[model samples]
Target: MVRGKIQMKFIENESSRLVTFSKRKNGLLKKARELSVLCDAEVALIIFSQKGRLFQFSSSNMENTIEKYLEHGKEEETTTNNTEVQQHVQPLKHEGAFTAKKIEFFESSKRKLLGQDLGTCSVEELHDIHIQLENSLKTIRARKAELYKEDIKKSKAKEKFLFQENTRLRKQCGRKPNQTPEKQKEIASCSQRTVSLEVVTDLFIGLPPFQ
Candidate 1:
């Protein structure tokens, strides 16, 4: 019995998809090994399932074959026709490029999850990472802004209370015994310093120490 050509698209049925994947994967690996042996060529293959399963093969030591393949690839310019054969023999080489990117993404994420990113990343990678950080920073900044506003409101309230208290104290100072002009000045200076510290701490609230 003969089967008609299957359409090139995602298989909707899980059982059929698995069966096709298994059959094609086996055939692809078989062809790869045969080519390597008969033609005395090096080969490596790598496949990742949509479910993230990995399958791989090599003719010789995988590393040596991969290195040799890369060196040879540099010497030859492969077009579309040759590309099909090249991909068949060394699918890993193609997949490796994408895998490298995926590895970088995961490594970057791992660093962030572990609190070790520390703002060190390449420009392009940093760009994507920046979005995530910017969103986090936005939240922090909003919260910080809210806190600052609240703090400022409290400070204004305190200032109004102090102003009224000072007015009362000044009225009393003239009448009260043993209160001096120098002590009033010192109290005012201490309050000013406290306000300055609050402002400085508020400025530092959402910023990283290094940046």
Candidate 2:
């Protein structure tokens, strides 16, 4: 008799599930090691079990592999951003321009902004460009001021909230607060009394003195 192929579904029984996990985990690690040895490749494998038990393997140090992966990802991101350079300018007065004309306009404007190919620009065009730059600078400054004000407002609100919370917590815990009129009032109104816990017998049955 030949063994049947196992179905591709989760094992329901706990014992069977654990056995399968152990076998597969070892097999996967063995394969990773074999591939790294056979191909001289840098390989990193990480596994987390249902219980959060971690297993990892790396051709080299795991930390070094992680650093290399991060560096490579960063370099790839930079390259992708560098490849997606687009030159956009404000739309021309004639919105019905052809695609080629729009592209030409954008390229020309980009060059002008970069201070290149300015020989063909007339005095009026140069003046217009100067006005646009001045307006752009004004807009940028306005936005920066708005952001600064918003950030400062948020910081002030946060500081006020934290101080209030600290005061409330201190009062709740009956702890002395920083020197202030309220702290002085609290200290002044407070009084301490010694508590006597002695017990006296009140079961005396003897006759009292005759009146």
Best by TM-score: 2
lDDT of 1 by residue, 95-148 (tens): 888899999988979797455865676777767666878898899999999999
Residue 182, model 2, lDDT: 50
Error of 1 at 146 (Å): 75
- Which candidate number has the best lDDT? 2
Candidate 2: worst-modelled 10 consecutive residues by lDDT: 85-94
Q: lDDT by residue for model 2 over 1-211, one digit each (tens)?
A: 9999999998899999999999999999999999999999999999999799999999999999999999999999988776664212224324536777989999999899778899999999999889988999999999999999999999978876777788788999999755554565676656322223344556757886578
**After aligning candidate 1 to the native by TM-score, how far in Å is the CA of 11 from where it should be?**
0.6
Write down the TM-score for model 2: 0.39
What lDDT would candidate 2 get against the real structure?
Answer: 0.84
Cα RMSD, each candidate: 27.3, 34.9
RMSD of 2: 34.9
